[model samples]
Target: MTATDNSTVRDADALRADMVRALHDQDAITSEPVAAAFAVVPRHRFAPEAPLDLAYDLHSTVPVKKDENGLNLSVMSAAHLQAVMLEQADIKPGMKVLEIGSGGYNAALIQELVGNDGVVTTVDIDRDVVDRARRCLDDAGYGQVKTVLADAEAGVPDDAPYDRIIVTAAAWDIPPSWIKELTGNGRLVVPLTVRGTTRSIAFDRDGEGLISRSYRLARFVPMQGEGAAKERKALLRDGVVVQTDDERVPLNTKALNQALDTPRREFWSGAAYDLPDELELYLTLHLSSAARLHASKEIVDSGFVETSALLGVPALVSEDSIAYRTRRENEDTGGFESGVVAHGPQAEALADEYLKLLRRWAENHRCRGAATIRFLPGPAPSTLPENSVLKRHGIVAVSWH
Candidate 1:
């Protein structure tokens, strides 16, 4: 290993301890095996370009790349977020796990967790990333984890019947091949996007259907290769990409599409920090059946929403999202707070009728300080990374219990 690689390994050891503490603080991880696995796996090794300080920032989202237009391509998810996924997955030794995105550092953690009994097969569309991961894993003596240079959308069918499947990259929908390849009761944890919002959804197969038990707002690089397209290959309306999905519902269609020009003057409408009574009731009835449950973030002026002192909620999104801010401040803010100007689909009057359900979810279920959202697998198996909506463009409510 080079000098930089050696330093990263050392930093990971320290970062692992901090990560454990952060997990405990959030009440996100409870498994000892999983925690130990994360501790041993060197994250910096996989992401060579990331800064040293970021290697251990518990709540940081490591940026992978950005285009000239300022669009982010990929990110290394926060430690707590990944920990939640691993805990939900209940990954065990002797089980075969199919992982998307060949990040050497993350794969190393999986390899350590699976031990010799378990096998990890990672696929990535970028040949360069795949090759880099291969070298990192091999150098770290984790060559046992098989690395494949292929489009993740295709799903590694040759290694079918996997006990667990995890996609590091965010997908629009769960590819049908992945569902087909899963063993009965198998788990599939994918970062899903629905109606322009992205979330990490974890589901388990139950007979003919799949049930989502957990979800989180997450962002990652879009998938590429056989199951993905190279360019937009479409027209844009006012710089926004348009969808061609069949529209059946007409409720507030115009209002949903209409853009607001003037800002509303409402101070802490109880919409940002607290859920309204109406929304609380909705979530109670449909929390279980909620489908395509994804979350998005919006930053508004503090004048509209009341905030605490100078230490306002720097990032004003809900629980199911990654912070859109600098890493240094995100750790201190810990995301949303009591006082801050926040905006979301749930907060909009056009969507508020159904979004209020999210509030009830917080009251009924103990979110471990965060809310639980679910995304169901879509009808089309071919569209692995496309949003799968049940009703409108947004997440639809589904029944769980």
Candidate 2:
């Protein structure tokens, strides 16, 4: 090989080693098989358009395809997240795996985990993504992995009864086909969006339904096509918005905007605030009229909304009022204390309800992984279970213990 070719190879190898070490240090790579896979995969080959540094970045995603509006339609998911999900899947050699989203690198990594005896098929809704993934896989010497061009909402039944089904995109619900196509003891690791937040939940078949083994906070491009999210969004102003999928949550945009004009009310919960993911799950599920409150940095900087809204926070909404969580540093509480910010005539009542839930969570479920999530795949029950969110395919029931 020429000197320039040798240098490029060395650089890629060095970056791969660094990436594996960082993933291991962060506890994302817990098993030897996963670490080895990360060590060997030439991640940069999958996203040839991206720089080598970006391809190896532990926490950054490499964009592959974009839509007409410049929104990402497909991306090579971040390495740390890939490692975390792989650990969650716990793939064994000779297992048949079907990945719901097409990204060549992740599917290649799965091929490494499953070894030569296993089958790896990746499906995507976008034809461009499937074509790109196929080219990248062939270029990266992973041509053994099958690529399918179709919406993964129904999953790839051509290879049924997969031992593991890993979804790379954010899913709104667990469709019936996914469960039926899985082996009796199969595992489905999906980034499931509940309320407005997404969690990478590792679920195992429990009778006809599925139950979570663990869940981690996750962010991903929303799934497109048949399984797209049905959430409604109201742009209250240039920098603020409210979104919800719950039919009962009143989306009175005019009244909600008027509430923002009224004086804001603050209520302190006197409860220690930490473990944001766990706290958020509790708030979103328990709030009667739950919605997500989001604000741009400009609005937050102008003092119209708390920084919490910058990344979307659980909100209790009424026809003409809203209350959401905020935080402040408190030495007595060990770090921060949770509080509620309210607006409109029912601010006091909304704040009271929000504060009660916050305190209850802090007192009873302050730690991580305290909630158990179950996906009951069937018609909605006449009386929905407490702390449950309804979906087109089924109901997501979550309980904190």
Candidate 3:
């Protein structure tokens, strides 16, 4: 090989080593097998067009394809996120694995974990993504990894049962096909979005339903095809918006905007504010009429809504009112105290209901992995459990334990 090629090879090796160490330090790589896979795989080879630094960046994603509106269709997920999900899967050598979203790099990592005796299949709805993944996998010396063009809703059943099914996209629901395709003791690691919030949950089969082993904060491009999320969004104004997946929640944009014009009311919970992600899950699940409130930085800077709305905080809404989470510096509450901000005619009621949840979450489920999520397939039971969110295929219920 030429000296230029030799230099590029050396650079990649050094970068890969750095990435492995960083993943370990970041606690993304916990297992020796996962570390070995990260070390051996040529991550840059999967994103050849990308700069070496970007390909090796611990927390940055390399864009692959984009829609006409400049929105991402697919991206090579961040190394840190991938490592975290893989560790959740905990695949063993000679195990059958299937990756729902086709990204050559992740599939290649799965291939390394499964080894030569195992098989890896990656399926994607976009033909371009599938073809690109196929080419990249071949170039990265993972030719055995199969790439297929199809919607992920109906999994690659030809492979029968996969010991581990890892979904890279943000799935709205756990389709029956996915559970049917998993082995008896199989685990599926998916970025499951509910109530407009996404979490990468590692679930294992329990009877006909699936139960969560652990969940971590995650963000990904929404899944496409039949399993695509039925997103409900209302633009309150140029810079403010409300989004929800639950059809039960009303998004009266005009009334809500009018309510914003009313004076804002503040309600303090007098509870400690820690572990925001966990608190978000509890609030979203327990809130009777839950939606997500979002505000652009420009609008936030204009002093319209609190900073919590900037990150799309859980909101409780009525026909003419809205209330969302907020925080304050409180030495008594041990640094920060959770609170609620409300607007419109029913502000007091909305704020009261929301405040109750904020205090409940802070008092009880304030720690990590405090929720047990169960995906029960088929039609909902006549008597649904508390904190259950209805889905097309099944019911996703969460309980704080």
Candidate 4:
């Protein structure tokens, strides 16, 4: 090869090595197989339009496609997240794998894990994405990874009984077909959206339902086609909004906005706050009336809302009152202390309810992976279980042990 070509190859190899090391340090790459896959995959080839540095960045996603309104339709997920999910999958050599969302780089990594004897099939609802992934896989010498253009909601039935199925997009629920298509002992790793928050959960088959082995905080583009989320969003003002998938949660936009006009009330839980992901999972599930509260930087800067709302925090909403979690550094605790901010006439009641949950979590389930999630597919029961979220296809029941 020419000197210029040799230099480019060396640069890509260096970046890949750095990314693997960072992922390992963060505990995202916990297995040798996963580390090897990340080290070998030429991630930059999948997103040729992006800079090489961006392709190898550990925390940033490379956008692949956008919609008419300039929203990302698909993106190459960050390397750290990919490594986390792969480790969660625990794919072994000669294992047949099905990827719900098509991204050439991830599929290539899967190919490396599965080896020559294994089969890899990737499906995407968008034809453009399928075409792009197909070309990228071929260019990267991963043509053995099959590409299919179809809505992943139905799954690729022709290749049923996959040992492992990894979904890249944010799924609202686990469909019946996915469970049926997997082998009896297979594992399905999906970024499932429960209420308004999403978590990447690793589930193993259990009878007609699925049970989680582990879950971690994750964010991804929403799934398209038949299984799209049915969540509702009400814009309270220019850059403030509340979103919820639960039908029981009230979305009184006018009343909520008016409640914001009143003075804000703050309630301190007097409990140590850490392990935010675990805390959030408990709060979102246990809150009687829950939704996600979001505010823009402009509103936060104006002192109308705290920075917690900037990224959408779990909120307790009543007819005319709202309360959400906030944090303050506690010198004694050596970290942060959880608190509540409420508004409207029933602010006291809402804040009391929210504060109770915060303190309960801190007292009982403050550690990571304390909650176990189970997806029971079929018709909903007359009385929904406590800490359960209903979906079109199943009920997501979460319990702390």
Candidate 5:
């Protein structure tokens, strides 16, 4: 059957159950409230145009809105990642919640979890998204929730003292105003970029100080409108494509595009793992740091293919890994190194560290277990590294200036 035809048969309840199962598999649906919220919200309604195969995928991203350039501007987010955010927030009923990016799907889910006693106010910079979200909510019988088409950076101050605030986009830094608007004991969950890695973190305001509990590696479309981020420089290397725009950071698919043509056999044929894969892996890990250290990747073709061949590339890290494609031109040898391009030392370092961490994390945890990665703002330590463990509850702490 066609995608829309399939959507007709699979109702929201069934889809929600499947989503719950997916979250459970990822260890994200730990709370009964979060599970019920996922069960009650109809995700398909929010992303009607998604492919049929993706309708039931637990960790797939469903595009909700795309920009003029065909870039996804907003999305429903991956099911597992959403669950991770909820779990991290420790959402409860009767809590006033502020959602920076609003749509019927996410607001409805939050409203269901917060229950009738609680209040949910969603804000979006784009009036179109706001109006569309309103229509969707009304259609879904969620008229009680409030939606505003204004800058999220200023925040919904009139309704200040929110018990919980969730920002569903990648933010360069948490606005001080958001913290001030939060309740004395409020929780502000945001996807924060540290160095170059984006991880969702739930920061709780305790008295005058703020503390974070959970962290999960995540990738989200950049937050736009009022507090939009400044553009970042693109990394340029031989045999790769780079694209940039005025508002957002430059696209960094040079390495990914290069991976498509590079034969996997270049790295894997002689060794147990693929060389191109290893190089790619190194790039991913180091990119996080490179984004922090040097806003760009500068690779000099060092012909270190043999060194890369020795180290087996670690398996993919997260669900988003599926979104990437590594292809080959000829069938004779695995096209591990044809399409892929190595940007710079940072990319290579990221790939190398990713391999090491994958092995270490797997050995220690056995299962990823819906683990969260969080970055917390902390004062640089006198003796320890800037991000040293200021406080550790159940998540890792990476300090951001």
Candidate 6:
């Protein structure tokens, strides 16, 4: 219990070292301190039930707990994402860090970054997760790390003024408490979901508002409790789905489903298709009515939908029609060119709208991290700014250069 079970000790060490090397190779671990922390955390110990290969897998998450519906309630986030966030945090020795979700492995890594003088606390709303994390932390020689069983929405008041607050879950909005709890210059790295896409954004306080320093494409389990997302979902038959958080976007499942029966229309933007993440953010924010279209492989294979929706693609949705991004390799461009696929009675109108956005992104803001995301905490203004999403706590405003 003191170190990894001796039986797997050698294997775990070698796996851990290999994992660190792979993180560096992938550019997930940039600084020496984060690399050192990953090098020693004994990740396999936290997920003892998982296979060593899976536990140390760089891009895979080791599931910790799931609900009766088979949805993940908690997971050991992918090591690659963890490293990226830690680097974004830039944790210094003797700095205090509060991890919003409890997972022994991440807390252990944070402990290493903070060193002897720094304090680390992990909180979870579920008692079972807290108890399990406490047990794992103790077994892994991270007893110094504190485990609290409480809803993380309130930001662990007893340990006020954290140097860094890192949320492992995907949040719909930045609560006022999280910003209030940060030290004057403290940073918060959270996976914030906007429109329908989620990005891990590093936010620093700018007066009473929060401005993003950087944002990376990330996927994580949605937060539970007070900060849970209030998304509207529509099932347009067996394998096709559409969802959005913007209350203004209409989701008429029956009408949209019928639109699928109409002949499909395709339009090319004449713009190069690359840096999909950046393009997606721009489209999601700039679209007048944005939603996400998702399709199972079966649907895509049946020639009913494009492969872009297999994971989820930004869609411009109207009352009875939908237009989502698609791409095809073009010899002239030397790569893929952005295009649109529209369905329903308004297919032409929707496709024209979608194509314009695609061309605009390629011409003006088609680069990594081109969008500037800002969160202003307070009541909504009488007239909200353009490209602004309203949340319970604040309005998220995004702009492009």
lDDT of 1 by residue, 1-401 (tens): 99986776676777667877778778777888887887677676666677767866777877765557887555666777778778877888889999897667677777777889999998887776787778879877798999998776667888889999998876655556777889998998887654334557787886644667776656567765554422211121232222222232122313322322224312221222332222222332332222111111222232322222122112212222111111112334354312112233333432333333333343454223243344444453443332234522123334322
TM-score, one value per model: 0.66, 0.98, 0.98, 0.98, 0.64, 0.98
User: What are the per-model numbers of colliding residue pairs?
Assistant: 20, 0, 0, 0, 34, 0
TM-score, candidate 2, is: 0.98
Q: Which tens-of-lDDT digit does each residue in 1-401 have in candidate 2?
A: 99987998899999999999999899999999999999998998998899889989999999888889999988999999999999999999999999988989999999999999999999998888999999999999999999999888777899899999999999998888899999999999999999999999999999999999999999899899988999898899998999999888999999999999999989998999899999999899899999999999999999999999999999999999999999999986479999999999999999999999999999899877899999999998899888898899899999787
- Candidate lDDT scores, in order, read 0.55, 0.93, 0.92, 0.93, 0.59, 0.92
Which tens-of-lDDT digit does each residue in 310-351 have in candidate 4?
989999999898999999999885899999999999999999
Give Cα distance to truth, residue 272, candidate 3, Å: 0.7
Error of 3 at 133 (Å): 0.8
Taking the tens digit of each residue's C-alpha lDDT, what string does model 3 give over 1-401? 99999999999999999999999999999999999999999999999999999999998999999999999989999999999999999999999999988889999999999999999999999999999999999988999999989998988899969999999999999999999999999999999998888999999999998999999999998899998888789899998999998788999989999999999999999998888888998888889999999999999999899999987999999999999999999975458999999999999999999988888787777887788999999997887788888888999999887
**Candidate 4: stretches off by over 4 Å:** 1-3
Locate the minimum summed-lDDT window of 10 residues in model 6: 1-10
Deviation (Å) of 6 in candidate 6: 3.6
Better of 2 and 6 by lDDT: 2
Off by over 4 Å in 5: 1-12, 51-53, 207-209, 238-289, 292-385, 388-401
Q: Whose TM-score is higher: candidate 1's or candidate 2's?
A: 2
- What local lDDT does model 3 show for residue 270? 90
- The residue-by-residue lDDT of candidate 5 on 173-214, one tens digit each, is 666678788888889899865434466878777555466666
lDDT score, residue 75, model 1?
60
* Cα RMSD (angstroms) for every candidate in the order listed: 8.9, 1.0, 1.1, 1.1, 9.8, 1.6
